[model samples]
Target: MVEKHTPSFIRKGSGKKKADTTEQFEKAVSRLAEGKYVLRLYVAGMTPNSARAIANLKKICEEHLAGRYDLNVIDVYRKPTLAKGEQIIAAPTLIKKLPLPMRKLIGDMSDEGKVLIGLDIRTR
Candidate 1:
């Protein structure tokens, strides 16, 4: 029987691996980049609705984008300036700033499936 051997062209630094095009590299960068999802949860005071919204958003972020997101819980009542900057008109508004196509969800955010789908965090 003939002995099998590795091809000469398969040596190290042979450039056989696919080169990362701009788009491919960008996509990879976006995927691998940690803390890419910047979420700001705007709430009002310590009302039950606000508390519920915070809890739901926190759970969703931890479950879906754990270690890949930065969640800033902003109590608009405590810090009204933050609202002016983000133009938050309603309580318990979640804003996804990064990962492109910014989205806003206004509610208690108790709807897991809806929240996931809205923020593009739902996996197929």
Candidate 2:
């Protein structure tokens, strides 16, 4: 049996490789620029509540805001000062930083519809 040749991948410890091609990336970016949103999620620690929030946020991001959101999950436990600066009185709070007005949603973020509405993500 003849062996097939495969391209070798070098160990680039930088990070993940892009899943999309240039065209796809451009399309995603264009979609993002059109009514896209920037999100900052504050978590207190690695507790169950924090984990739930992260999972739910990811769910919303993937299902509704796929290519249209920039999610930043900041752990207050790691940086309590940041939390103080942001004046976060609650754990697992999602702050919509972009697309204006800056609305905040505090909870586990388990409700997809609520998350979508909060993030201004209109689905088809």
Candidate 3:
């Protein structure tokens, strides 16, 4: 007679683990869908790029985030200390502070798709 052994993950009770993982994923998605977003944009004065970034971000927020977001625009020229605290190395930097797992996007924010993805906004 030959002895056989099954891997721990392949055992019968392992199905419970899979179920738990699926439940956790669903809960996470639900939280993200209902969570409020906190955002901060660091800009260098009212330069063209900074202005564009602000405009683009506002448009996206109104379209997607709507009443679920808080946006703060900071001019580095007027608030260098705030910029340094956030470690902003560029003129136009957008930081997504809430909804967990902070994300940063740099540039004029002209690309809607990229900005949406960066802000974790799911497209309908």
Q: What is the TM-score of each candidate against the true structure?
A: 0.67, 0.67, 0.70
Number of the top lDDT candidate = 3
Q: Residue 22 deviation, candidate 3, in Å?
A: 33
* Candidate 2 vs 3: which has more lDDT: 3
Report clashes for each candidate as comma-separated counts: 0, 0, 0
The most accurate candidate by TM-score is: 3
Instruction: Tell me the TM-score of model 2.
Output: 0.67
Q: Please, what are the lDDT tens digits per residue for candidate 2 over residues 1-48?
A: 001001111112112344568875665457456866667777776778
Tell me the lDDT of model 2 at 101. Answer: 61
- In model 3, where is the ten-residue run with the lowest total lDDT? 1-10
How do the residues 5-114 of candidate 1 rate in per-residue lDDT, one tens digit apiece? 11111112212255669875575467547536766677777678877887787677777776677566666776677688889999878888766678899999988988
Global fold similarity of model 1 (TM-score): 0.67
List the global CA lDDT of all models.
Answer: 0.68, 0.66, 0.72
Which segments of candidate 3 are over 4 A away from where they belong? 1-34
When 1 and 2 are scored with TM-score, the better candidate is 1
Report the C-alpha lDDT of model 3 over 2-97, residue by residue, as the tens digit.
Answer: 011112112222122335878866755675687867677777876889778877887788788777775677667766676778899997998887
Comparing candidate 1 with candidate 3, which one achieves the higher TM-score?
A: 3
Off by over 4 Å in 2: 1-34, 122-124
CA RMSD for every model? 17.3, 11.0, 19.1
Superposed by TM-score, candidate 1 places the C-alpha of residue 94 at a distance from the truth, in angstroms, of 0.6
